[model samples]
Target chain A: MGQPAPAVLLPDMSAAGEVSLESLRGKVVYVDFWASWCGPCRISFPILEQLRNELGPEGFEVLAINVDEVEADARQFLADVTVSYPVVRDANGTTPLAFGVMGMPTGYLVDRTGVVRVIHQGFRKSDGEPLRASIVELLGE
Target chain B: MKTLTSLLMAVVLCGCETVQPWERGILAKEEMQWQTNVSEAQLRNQIYASKEASSGGAGASGGGCGCN
Candidate 1:
């Protein structure tokens, strides 16, 4: 899991432009692949937002990659559960293909050096503690 | 005959394709479910199980009275 993260360039759901993973190289990034239909994502989003807010000043970033086929579903989901992090839309499903994502709500933790250290699949309430610990360790590094 | 059967089997297997995780949105749609109406399907299963005097094979287990 130490490989460099695959380049991601997708339409920014939060703003008018695009967002690229290359621009966030120096920060510890959590690249989360999610969809509105994914049940676990509803639980994961708020926790991820909490993590981002808590660790953001320390250079931790959560870049959400939405893989919803219909952009309206994603917008509806965001309207219900809001987050301040930059959310990008991979409506064509290319990013998940490049990442070889096998399940919904998968996450890749990329260290400050852009190397993927963790590939997390499926999220639950109990996963938050360990995930935070891992991010903290990477930030320490 | 054996060789022809094996060839036919291979050809049949070639028609199957694995659905990738990201492409499963269509499958997750309400219209794609085998039983879109959950309560109706459950009731049908319950009645069938009651008639057969069997339970627990499909979904939730229930008594054979069909009351469940």
Candidate 2:
């Protein structure tokens, strides 16, 4: 059985208002939990960004949440790696806690119906291929 | 009576500090985390160094001992 994703409504660092996972129900949503200090998170961000850019028009969205307690640290990280997708700050670390994130750079792929199709923890370059394939397949559905 | 006692002992021995999947969310809470104890460690090291008249890796350039 597909599990429904936990409710997520967080402050957008780049925008003025909050962005909710509920608002992204019809799209294939990728909910990412990342921290600036996590080494693998640095490796995963650009690759996930590419996937989002390539598949975004096909009803896919990447909602990357920065779990740094200090929002400025996340901003500094963004300065080094610029991505097009909507990025939000979970300064209180509430969302990652809710998602049961044991490590940094955890990702949850939700289908269009808001069901969690997959959960990925940590990332490598080759991991993107399988992830992209899954995204494409989800888009086809 | 012996069999019943053995069964109870086996069950108690098997159940040592295993957190379930659903209960992991509580364990993942920020308050339940120990990563923030780095400062506590730093404080301990500083106190030890001060008492021993030794200063090393105290965020400054010093090759006092424990390999920089």
Q: Output the number of the lDDT-best candidate.
A: 1
How far in Å is the alpha carbon of B50 misplaced in model 1? 1.8
> What DockQ does every candidate get?
0.63, 0.05
- Note the Cα lDDT for every prediction shown: 0.93, 0.81
| Clash count (model 2, backbone only) | 0
Candidate 1: which pairs clash?
none
Q: Which has the greatest DockQ?
A: 1
Residues A35-120, candidate 1: write the lDDT tens digits.
Answer: 99999999999999999999999999999999988889889999999999999998787889888898998999999999999999
lDDT of each residue in B1-68, candidate 1, tens digit only: 99999999999999999887877777899998998899999778978988988777776777777677
Chain A TM-score values, per prediction: 0.99, 0.96
Reference-based TM-score, model 1: 0.86
Docking class of 2: incorrect
